[model samples]
Target: MKQLYYAALIYLVLGLAGGLGYREITKANGFTGDTQLAVVHTHLLVLGMLVFLVVLLLEKTFTLTDSRLFPWFFWVYNAGVVWTAAFLAINGTRTVAGEPTGAALAGMAGFGHILLTAGLVLFFVCLRSRLSTSDTAPTTTIGR
Candidate 1:
């Protein structure tokens, strides 16, 4: 889980660098338009960094009874995020390049977002069930 968290953080940093590089190159080329850098930044921070960290924390804090779901949730959510980020980056680049709009690309981005949302919801549900079933016993200290 720590490794996954670090990997997601690395991707977030890379996304930042990519956005900044795009801006610099565009500015140097004297190109200006609505490239949606804000969207890219938000997506990177939320989906890439925030979501992955949350998953890691959840894994560490809870002992899931049904461990079978963990791998499914992890893979689906990560894949969804990666797909979304990749498509958004491509779309942003194409928009900046003044290329013809592709419906398939837009659809891919939308599908990825949907996948991510679904994965997160499923993960939360699983976690909630496990936590509720666990016994919460009060702790006592002998010294006290």
Candidate 2:
């Protein structure tokens, strides 16, 4: 749970930076169209920060980190976020600067998506395991 909390905080910083970076960089470049950079901040906020915060709550109720798959989910999901964000920054900057784009960055982004999907599957498996093993304690009941 502490890990999740920390991860969320870290991502919050990164997300803010991403949004600011996108705006300033675009303005500086005098670019006026949409680019992959636009979504980077939202992705970091939703996937990296918000998801981890939610999982921290889930961990309190379901003890999700107890599962063998939890660590895998953590690492893989983070890797995906980082990979995807890096690609967006790189490709987006190139596009903004009127540089030719390449397929390699797209390929890397696709792989990041794969990692994210795998991480989600693992999270669900851990969730299901917890669901089957025990009932939620009323004290920890969410949305009360």
Candidate 3:
């Protein structure tokens, strides 16, 4: 949980910094044609920061620490997001600068997507196990 919290904070910084950095790069370079770099910040926020934060909070509602899959999901998901963001930055800059993106970058990005899908499946599996257990304690019980 602490690790996840730290990861989320890191992503928050990365997302904000990435957004500002990409924006300044475009502005300074007079890039008005294609701005795929625009999504750099969004991807970090949504896939990295937001997802981790949600998982951390879910830990409070459910015993995520007990799961065999949560740790794997956490690491795999972060790796995929990082890989995807790196390529997004690279290809986005290339596109904005009117350079050709080679096949290697595209292949790497596709691999990242595949990893992201696998991580999501693990997350869902962890969530289903927690929900299916009747002995699981509710963080907020409403009924009297």
Best by TM-score: 2
Q: Which one is best on lDDT? A: 2
Instruction: Report each candidate's C-alpha RMSD, comma-separated, in the order given.
Output: 2.8, 3.8, 2.6
Candidate 1 structure, TM-score to reference: 0.79
- TM-score of every candidate relative to the true structure: 0.79, 0.91, 0.88
Point out the higher-scoring one by lDDT: 2 or 3: 2
| Tens digit of per-residue lDDT, candidate 2, span 81-133 | 88888888888988999998789889988888888998899889989988876
lDDT of 1 by residue, 1-144 (tens): 656678578768967876786777567656687664436666777777877777677667675425667666777777787778778778877777677658998999999988898878778777877676554645579999
Quote the lDDT for 127 in model 2: 91
Give the local distance difference test score of model 3. Answer: 0.87
- Model 1, residue pairs in steric clash: none
Give all candidates' CA lDDT scores: 0.73, 0.90, 0.87
Backbone-clash count (model 2): 0
Candidate 3, 1-144: lDDT as tens digits: 898899999999999999998989898889887666899899999999999889899888776768899888888888899999999899888887788999998889888888899999999999888877736555576895
TM-score of 2: 0.91
Q: How far is candidate 3 from the true structure (C-alpha RMSD, Å)?
A: 2.6
